[model samples]
Target: MNQQALSAFIWSVADLLRGDYKQADYGKVILPFTVLRRIDCVLAPTKQAVLAEFEAKLAAGVNPDPFLFRKAGQTFYNTSKLDMRTLIGDPDNIAANLYAYIQGFSEDVRDIFERFEFATQIDRLAKAKLLYQVTEKFARVDLHPDKVSNMQMGQIFEELIRRFSELSNETAGEHFTPREVIRLMVNLLFVEDDDILSKPGVVRTIYDPTAGTGGMLSIADEYIIEHNDKARLVMNGQELNPESYAICKADMLIKGQDVSNITFGNTLSEDGHADAKFDYMLSNPPFGVEWKKVEKDIRAEHEQKGFNGRFGPGLPRVSDGSLLFLMHLISKMRPAADGGSRFAIVLNGSPLFTGGAGSGESEIRRYVLENDLLEAIIALPTDMFYNTAISTYVWVLSNRKPAHRKGKTQLIDGTLFWQKMRKSLGSKRKEIGDADIVTLTRLFGNFTEAQIATLFDANGKEVGRRMVHKGEFQPLPPEGGKIKLAPLSRIFPNDAFGYRTITVERPLRDEQGNIVVGTRGKAKGQPQADSALRDTENVPLSESVANYFAREVLPHAKDAWVDEEKTKVGYEIPFNRHFYVFQSPRPLEQIDSDLKQVTGRILQMIGELSA
Candidate 1:
């Protein structure tokens, strides 16, 4: 069966779970059983041999892990004689047999079901007398790798998770990112290195700090293998949610990866791969989620291990820890001398300009821009996620940028490159089509400032669009029509995002309008600054501070002087402002005509009623 049918078949088991299980608890029983059935089918071919080897090793008094691994030809093996098919033979003792069958698997596989809390789910099903029916429903289907690839399985599971999350009123985005978004990120990530990645023996590592069901890792692997069959793509990740971690680990295990590399628990509190680094990384951390739970651990590292820890750049506010994940990924980047790393992260609009100068958010932005790690940040269309309708951005950073891109950052406005979905999924009402994805990828690869000229018919309906490159000929307006041009891509120097927040002080004066002079040490003859008259101004880093102060500030306040002691350097990306195009409103004649038409229609309706 295809992914949709398979997902539907698995979700069909929910019929037996309803009334016996709450809508929120349906996933608890269904997901574990689905995974169980898949693993059972995979181990079936070598089941007898593994059992024989286990018995032989036990008789000889030796560890059989190595022997069993070889016998099963898989990372995990089962020693129990009862498989999914056999459990149904004795429905009266189904619970006991199922539990035993689960315990028979290797510790790693068992741990997944354990985190899934399968034993409790089993008991709950047994008490409700729905265990047999649910088991039969999943067992009747096929989930073997030969039939369903890892990508298919991940998507299927994500669909089910989406349904369950909706029933529980939870955000599905917290569990998995949309596959199309991952594709665009992967394309942007691997585009510049196409020549390097196409080599036969090329090897690369991919990691995601927030591995939400391992979608990003799986997509990265698929992309590499598709381009070069001999290329090896190593996947690693960490997840905090137990259910999500279990699913991610299970997916990796079946794909023949080191399940141990995909870990569980809070990544901020515990560094699963502390001393490890990678070549490429991607993450979709929970949007606007707080990091208060791990504040103690993160703060400790930032304080004592300054510039020596993962959070050395700085910490974001406790209310939104999206930048913390970015910093964590930054730490995982391999040294530039050893061929540095490229990473991408999905973030909300807040990170672009949330805090003021010297605040944690601004400091993080400063570190990224001043260090020139930012390559590009593409703005995605709103309502593209399963949960949030707010505008989101994809930040691509690299320590080893090409010579031409050095000290410059690209910003592509992709909000217009989306098609409305046939049917909405939760908050998701739009998707970036394959053609649109191609257009976006080409725009990024070209690294040029471009605009999209949209042509409108006389009645104001969009007819077509043309891409306009910088310094190139502009498309002429169509006859009896109009054309609107909006920025599609923009490039800026790294310092363009930075500024100096200068505090302006004015002389203090007595009630009689006389200057008040200080009598102490260095201030003995200087006028004391007035606290009430103090104000601040932000000067662009591209312009000299003194020049900006003289041009814009001194004219308004003749007595104001720069207080260099209180000045701070900060960075922010006012992304939307660059793409905003001003359009003059329609002429008064047009408005008067429209108003007259509306009034005429209203009078005609009234006259018809009176007649």
Candidate 2:
């Protein structure tokens, strides 16, 4: 069945939840039941064989796990004789039978249901006398692996969560990303490695610290498989939310993947894959979320472990921990002597230029740029997320930069690439369509300077667009139309985003107008800084501190001298500043004419009213 019809059919189960449960509470019943039914259908084909093997193994007093797995031909097995269809046989005691069936599954499968709190839903449904109906509604549908591929199942899962999110006015973005965005990121993550990834039987590993339904990992896996059927991508992820974690684990389990790779915990406080390294990683961590809860553990490591720990460079403000995840991903990068690694992460604008020089955020940016870890940063369209309408950016980094790309970072402006969605989902009113994704990928892959020309009619509505590579002739508009040519891609030196925030201080003077000199050891003969006149200025890393002081500061204060001890090197990606274009105001005659016309219209209205 198509996704819409399938989601609609699954949602029909909620019809039984009305009156007995709040609209927001519907997911608690629907999500778990849907997963249970899918699992039930998958285990049904070998149910009889698995149960017989279990009985025979028990009679012989041997471990049934291996035998049961062999009989089921899957990683997990349910040994109970009762299935969903069988549970429906006893409507009066269906709840008890359902519990037994769940308990009989292997530990991994059982853990999925446990994380979903399926037992509580069973008790609640049974208490409300809706247990049998809900079970029957779910059982009637067939979610066999043969009928529904893993991809379609994932879409159904997303649709269900989106519906629940819309009903409760919550953001599904917190649980998972919109797939188009994931596709674009995955494209960029693998764009530079076509040669290595296209080989048959090639094996690679992918990780996501903020797994969030494992959407990123699954998409990366899909990309690799589509790349080469023989190529394999091992997936690993960790999620903090119980429900998202359950959905993620269940999806992985059904795909014949090693579900143990997907873990559950706060990655910051507890490293789930402590010693694991990966060839590629992707994450859409909770943007602007606080790391205060794990501050103690993270701070201890930053101080104690230094460069040996994940947060070695520095820590961002506790209020927003987005940078922390970047550091963690960096730690997980395979050594350059090895195959090395590449990663993409979605972050809000804050990380680009929040903290000042010498601060944690600035230091993190400094470390990244100074070390040339950043590869490219793509600016996404605003309102593209389900939660907030704020602008977001995708940062792609790698330790093993191509020879030509060394010491350079590419920035692709994708803010204008989105198309309006036919239907809005929560805060998400726009989406990056396939065409947009291709354009973005091309811009990054080309890694050359380019501009996009937007044609607008006299009415000022956009009518056409085209990309012009550097040195190419710009596209022109039709008669009576105007064209806007803006830079679509730009490459910059790594140090372009680096600067030194120097503290400029003036000399202290006594009431008699004499400079006050310090009497202490270090400052004995030096002029005492006037605290009131102290200020700071960011000097570009390309310019020497003394030269900046001489050119910009000395003219205003002749006595000003550099405080070399207080100088601090910092970095920030002023993304918008690099692309800003100035527009001149209208001429005086034009302004006067427009005001006169408006005044004439007001006088005409007044005369008509009087008449």
Candidate 3:
């Protein structure tokens, strides 16, 4: 089916659930049913062939994996009671029959849905009169294997997740990584390396701890397929959401992928990929999330072994556990000899400058930086995800680096590398176009650093190149730069951790001779404007405001002041005129005259009080 037709079909299914659920909640019912219908369609073509092969295998007294054994060599087979065709045929009995079928199917693929107790959820839907309608609508949608190719199916997964993210008003970081992002990461992880693609004998494993609907894993699979190479693409993932977990497992089943390895659990506390090291790791874990340390045994084990082992050094602060996820992925990196791992993690600014020195979070970053495992950090543009317009960063870490990138880290400022979507479309989710991906991928592949500034030390010396400002215009380079238009690369010295303060000045008055406070700038062809308070200097205005609040506001607050303090009525200063209105400093002689008048007034007041 074409994209528009397919989208319309999916939207129709959504329409059925319109009143019953929110747009975001509609996916809870539609996603699973879509997977079921697709699986049924796949089985329809291969059913007889698979069943015959399974019979032969059983006759030969060979018992294979029941889930795999039942299907034999084909992608799917109809187990007597619960196939999609059978369930949809009897629409009246669909709620009960479909529930039974789902239960039976889950049992067969038990390993994939470890903690996923879908029966209760399914039952709830059934009681609410939802299963039949949703299933019937999905049966009409063309998610069948033949109708939509595997690549198209993956696109559908992305579209659905994106739509859901949009409905919920989630942040860009909360939405799943776009295909372009995944493609860039795949390129970074395997830069034209034929060994990972063309060699089947080489056992290579890729993992995504926060895998949402298995997009990253499937993209890796598709990458291997497109290269026309044969490598064992063992994909493992852990997802915490039960609904997403069910749908992801169904996706794996439809593609006939090995589902035993893709785990369903909270990755931080109950890591599903425990003891298994991966060669390539890619994930866009939720940007800012808090995790309960309920699994004390796991926490204690990692703590005892030290942070470098699993956690590295110190645990992250309780509120933001983003670094902990990175630490876990870092620990899963194998040595170079045993298919060394490289990771591309999408993160927000929190991990980069969150905790200060001696904090557990800082120690983890320090460990990675000191060990030189960090390769590059790229800042992406805002509005890159479906829900939010906040900027995020991607950190590339490699356990095994090529000789050229040994001691250096590359930082690319890609915040300006996106094309804005039409305001009419107004899709909250913005995306990096193909051109941006090629540019980012090629720059990463080449490890360029020219635009990147080297970090400096407190003593006015350069340390090493670390990060690029996200403000660089990714415009076409000049003719002589020899830069590729698709991907630009430059080399710079490393930016040391050292930082220095630079000062800039603003005039005290406008051209009109009006005193002003705070910064002022002009719009093109428009008059210059200052801040709301009209303060000439931001520093003085801020200091005066702070002093006014502390001395005037806080001292008089009823909740904070005691009875004794309440009786003390200090002169309340007029905040607006006292704080924002700027006045010229008096000359020294004028200041002396003012002090003499103030002293005489104070003496008169004292004499009156004495009388």
TM, every model: 0.97, 0.97, 0.69
**Tens digit of lDDT per residue, candidate 2, span 1-611?**
87779889999888889999999989999998888888899888898888888998999999999898888878899978899899999998898899999998999989988898899999999999999999998889899988887888888888888778778876335777889999999999988897546778788889999997788888888888788778888889999988779999988987778999999999999999997899999999887888899999999999999999999989999999999999999999999999899999999999999998889999999889888899999999988887778899999999999988899999989998999999997788999999899989988888899988889998888998999999899877867889888888999999999898888889999999999998999999999999999999999999888888889999999998878789898889999987776667989999999999999999999999999
**Per-residue error at 159 for model 2, in Å?**
2.1
Clashes of each: 0, 0, 25
Query: Model 3, range 1-611, lDDT digits (tens) per residue?
Result: 69657866876777667676777776666665566666667666556656565566668887633644455344434444457656778867876786566554435344333334445546766777876666666666656666788767767766776677667766545547767778877777777466876766666788889888788888888887777456667777888776567666767766666777777777887878778888889888887776665447546856677744677566777777778888889888998787578988988777876664456765676567557687877778777666555668788898787888876666666765677766412233566788778878877876654343334455545444333324565443333332222222333222232121112122234789764543445423333333332221112211343454456445644222112111211111111221132345879999999999999999999999999
Task: Please identify which of the two predictions, 1 or 3, would achieve the higher lDDT against the true structure.
Answer: 1
Residues 1-611 of candidate 1 have per-residue lDDT tens digits of: 89988998898898888787789988898888888988888898898999999999999999999999999998888999999988888999999999999888899999999899999999989999998988877778888888987889999988988888888877436877889999999999999996547778887888998997888999999888888888888899999888888888888888889898998888898989998999999999998988888999999999999889988878889999899988998889999999999999999999999999999999999999999999999999999999778889999999999988999999999999999999999899999999988899999888999999999887888889999999998788777889999999999999999999999999999999998989999889988899999999999999998899899999998988998999999999999999999989999999999999999999999999999
- List ranges where model 3 is wrong by over 4 Å: 22-24, 49-72, 103-133, 168-172, 192-194, 197-201, 292-299, 423-429, 451-495, 498-611
- Which prediction has the highest lDDT against the true structure? 1
Worst 10 residues of 2 by lDDT: 166-175
lDDT of 2 at 144: 92
**In model 1, how large is the Cα lDDT of residue 106?**
94
